[model samples]
Every structure is written in C-alpha cells, then in structure tokens.
Target: MRAHADAFIAYATDPDPRVRRASIEGLGLFLEDAERAVGLLQERLVHESGVAERVLVVQTMADLVLRLPAAAAPARAWFDALADSGSTDADTRLAALAHRARCAPDSIDDRTVPVVIELLRRVTPAPPPEQDPAPDDRRPSRCVHVRPRRRAIRLFPGTSPQHSTTSNATAGSMPPTPLLKALHEALGARFDDRKALLTEQLRSADRATRYDAIDMARRLIASWRGDHTDLAVHSPM
Candidate 1:
C-alpha cells in the first residue's frame, strides 16, 4: 500500500456510487502513499457533485491540512471555490465553511462571520412555536459521521464532569450541531494560543465569564467523547 498511489487513484474516476465511496475511502488510507491527496481533494471539491463525498473530502482534507500544513496550501482554493459555488448544495457549502472556519478562521472575519453565524443559527435547534404540535422529548437526530475521539483527544479531553456531559449531548445530535460548531469557532479563534486563552479565561476577572468559559470547555470535551463513542458503535470493522 505504501507504494500504491496509482491504485488509490483509480477510484477517483469510478462511476458506481459505492465504488466511488470506496475510492474516496481509499484516499484517506493512501494519504501516506498519495503525497498528492491534498491536490486531489482540491480538484474534487470543484468537480465532485455528491454531497456525502464532498463532505468526506472536506472533512478529511481539513484534517490532513491540519496535520500536514505544507499540504494545506491547495485547500485554501478549495475553501474559496466551495464558498463561491452557488451550484453547491447548502449542506455541502456549510460543511466547507465549517472546514474553512477551522482552516482559516481569520479569513472569515466581518464580511463572512455574519453569514456563517446566520447559517449556524438557522441550523440550530429551534424552540417550537406556541401553536406547533408537541414534539417528542427524545434527543434530536445528529450528524452521522463525527470522526472520532482519537482525532479530538489532544484538543478536548474530558477533565471534568461538565466536559463529560457536554460531550454526550454533542454526540447525540446530528452533524453540524451548533454546539460542536460553536466550540470549533471558539477554539479556532485562539488557534495555537489556545492553552493560554483557556488559562486566561479560567482566571478571568468576571466570575460569569470564567464560568461560561469553563462550561464551554466541558462541552467541548464531552463532544469529543461523544464523537469517539459514536464512531466505535457504528463504524464498520
């Protein structure tokens, strides 16, 4: 597999949905083999029409960019391309925006935050209208693929009860859950200086501020656990 980049490349053109999906799956496996996975994903972002495939590509490429910064350069164009594509579906665009929010938080400043925030708000759990029919008390359906806890272990470890609880709630919801997305924004804002910001927030002047930050931190940790647990339960072995 180490020397089989071409083998993985074959799936890039496969027509069958399952075959295409497997080919997309192979890209991740071949990340080590395919030095050009980043480039390949960038190209796919423009031409690929499948929502699930686009989401997977965006998510995988986002992780790859973060892990291999040198490989991340080409992804910036993908982000811009996705953002500019009026033809792309809302969910796919939103997923791309979410990745952009992670990959280039600063790039989404005054001009874009409002749009992203609006999208987030629209997708957020809505309080029922007064005249609406009573709904089930059960938790809502969540995004299907949340990566896993292994991916989030370093960024969000369940160090407190609050963290554990939040993690569960995040995992129980469908993909693009606002809480998970909010945490991503919050953490992205801090970037490499996260630890310092966490420490500062934990020691903030206002008691309310400290509590709020702590609460958010807990939720983040819990979300990571939820993602990990969900993957373990549903993943094909």
Candidate 2:
C-alpha cells in the first residue's frame, strides 16, 4: 500500500480527468492514509475547474479536514477562495464555507458565519404570494368538490422550540444539566420576547420597524424552507 500510495498521488494529478477521478475514488479505501489522500486531492484542486467536479472535491476535502485535523492548512486557502466575494455561484460558495466553518480548527477564528449568511441570502429564492382559492363554482376540492375563494391566504408555520441542537443551551452532547436546561429555556423565551417587541414596533407607525419586519419575514421563510421540498409543496397559511 505504501508503494502504491505514491503512484496514486501521481495519478491524482494526471492530465486525463478519468484518471484523476479514479484516484479520488480509490483514496476513499485507505482511511489510514490521510496524508497521502489529502496530498493527492490538494494537488488536483489546483487544476480542477468543472463546477460539479470542484463541488465534489470541496465536499471530500471537508471530510478529510474533519477526520484529519493535521491536514487543515492545505484546505484553508481553498476555503478562503471559495468564500471570496467574487464567487458567482452562491450554492457552491455557501456549501464550501459552511463545511469549513463547521470543521475549523480550535484556534481558528470564526469569520465564516457572516459570509455564509450572505451566501444563503443570495441563493434563497423569493416566495411567491399565495394564490387565492378557486371560487365555489370553480372549486376543485377533491376533484369535483373543490371550491375557489376570492381572497388569497398565506399561511405561516409557527416555530416549534422543543427541538435542540448540540450547541443549544438546553441539550448538549454531554450529560443533561439542569443549569444548562434552565439557561437554554430562558434564552429561548427571551428570543421570543424580543421578536414580540419588534412585532409591536412594526404595529406602530415606525417605518424602519416595518421594513425590518419585511426583511425578517423573507429570511425566516428562506431558512425554514431552504432544504425542504415538502414545506414548499404544502405552505399552509
């Protein structure tokens, strides 16, 4: 395996795309060869240009960095390039930056968050206004029983706060702690309170508040439905 490791690294930089692709595929078989695998992939990233191919390389590089922290430096420049302002493809840039942020080294400063949020804003498509239900005469309910309505109804799904991620105050990867749970719940409630306060501001004649509300609504919808096809299909108002 050691003898062929060098050979694989050579093939990884082959001029033929097929050989390069095969080298990437073969690297997956050797988890014990992190140095060799990453070295080979890093070489390919220099010349890789196809959108789809670069995406795959980025994903694979993320996995490598997370699994082999020692190899992170090699990927740092690539991630910086991906998150650059000149990046045109929002999806690629966002995915690359998010993966790097999640797998960053302990000493690494967290600057990728805003870049990711911006990329998310750029990639998210706007939601169209809800359609009015058909009139009673033209109703298509259950095929023949459906009815139409004159008014359009947009349904907003309420947030469910019961779920918790690892970083959430309530539940963490370690043992359950009462103090942590209390803090988490308090923070969640506080967030709800702040949102209500903004709502009240919007209710008044505050023009800025109204604009902020509009922006927040768009972002909330985008975050909730970004990766969810089901929500897109059944957005009940």
Candidate 3:
C-alpha cells in the first residue's frame, strides 16, 4: 500500500492527463488508511490544475467518507478549509461544496455560508460570441439557432470512490447553476440567521448577488419551519 501510494503521489502531477488520472484512481487503494489518503488528495488538490483530475480527487474523498464515516473527520476538515479559503479556485471551491453536501453536511457552519454565497455570485458563464454573417452572394442569410444542451446529472456512484482512469467524472455537474441545492443540503436546518442575511443580499444592485439571493431565499423558504429558538435575540434584531 505504501509503494502504491507513493507512486500515485508521484504521478499525481504528471504532464500527461492520462497518467495523472491513473494516479488519482490508484489512490483509492489507500482508503484503508483514509487519513493518509485524504492527506495525499489534499496535496494533489493544491497543485492539480486539470478540472477532471481535481473532480476525481474530490469525489474520491466523498467515497471515503461514505465507506468509513468514522474516518471522515480529516477529509471533512480539508474540505471545510478549502471551501472557506478565498484564494481557492472556483472549481475547487465548488467541488468542496459538493463534497460537503455529500459527506459532511452537518459540518457546514456559518463561516462556510458566506463563502458559498460569494462563490455563487462570482461564477457565471460569459455570453457566447456573436458571429459575423457570411459576405455577399445570395438570398437573405437565414439565422441558425443553437440551443444550449442541459447538462446530464451524474452522481459519484462507487462505494469506495475508486474507479478506473476512464471513470466518467465531470466538473460540469458540480452544483450547476443556482448553487442553492448543494448549499441547502450543506446548511441543513440550523441556519435561519444566515438565511436571513442572504435575504438582504438579494436586494443588492449586482446581478450575481441578486441571482444568488433568489436561489438561497427559495431554498430557505422551501425548507423553513420556524425560527431557531436556540438562537439568542440580538438587540438590533
């Protein structure tokens, strides 16, 4: 196991995507030593730039938690830090959100809520570029309409989170647009105050802020039962 783990760590940043992917898959063999495996994946995440490779590592951590819930604290802590770090990339942050939703929803706290909201507001796809009409020659040129395809929803399915190099891991479906579904799951029912805070952010002039506000408001409304009586009433409120 040590030899295999060492080899996986060495190849994790291989120039060839295939080699890197193979190394990511091979890391699954070390789940018996989940703390060590989690550490290795965390290291890879810090340096790995390819979206597919990062997704594989994040999903593998989720698998480890699923298989050995008792051993998940290290992995959960890693994700919590990643999700909260402002310097983290959007892809990594999104993966951390999804992993928390899947493996450690109860661990998501007030600190993570604001970070999730900020990330939701910032990650938007740019508009497609307009094309020039073909020059000269002919009858009126017809406009061709191309509809964007809906992304397929794929969940991490393996019990052990380990799969072959060709595993169909995708970053696209990692909490798609809106982001509230994953956030709702991660925040659970103990975040009424945070939900109210996001409600205020809904009134922002910024388009992304308003968009995230609506999604978060919808999530809170859909699940809200009553006020959190355990929370102290502040004088400002």
- Candidate of highest TM-score: 3
Better of 1 and 2 by TM-score: 1
- Residue lDDT tens for model 3, 1-237: 755567776786788977887767666655467777777778887777765567678777776777766658888778777777788777678778767776776666666666655554444333246577657654685898888453333333232223111111233423233234445555565566455445535533333334434545655655676653322232112
What is the lDDT for 95 in model 1? 70
lDDT by residue (tens digit), candidate 2, 76-166: 6667776674744664565456556545633223343344334433433333556876577564546465564422221111112342211
Alpha carbon lDDT at 111, candidate 2: 45
Worst 10 residues of 2 by lDDT: 168-177
**Residue 161 displacement (Å), model 3:** 17
Best by lDDT: 3
Task: Report, for all candidates in order, the number of backbone clashes.
Answer: 10, 11, 0
TM-score, predicted candidate 3 vs. hidden true structure: 0.53
Better of 2 and 3 by lDDT: 3
Ordered by lDDT, highest first, the candidates read: 3, 1, 2
Quote the positional error of residue 75 for candidate 2 in Å.
2.5
Q: Taking the tens digit of each residue's C-alpha lDDT, what string does model 1 give over 77-126?
A: 77777766777665566677767767666665544544544443433334
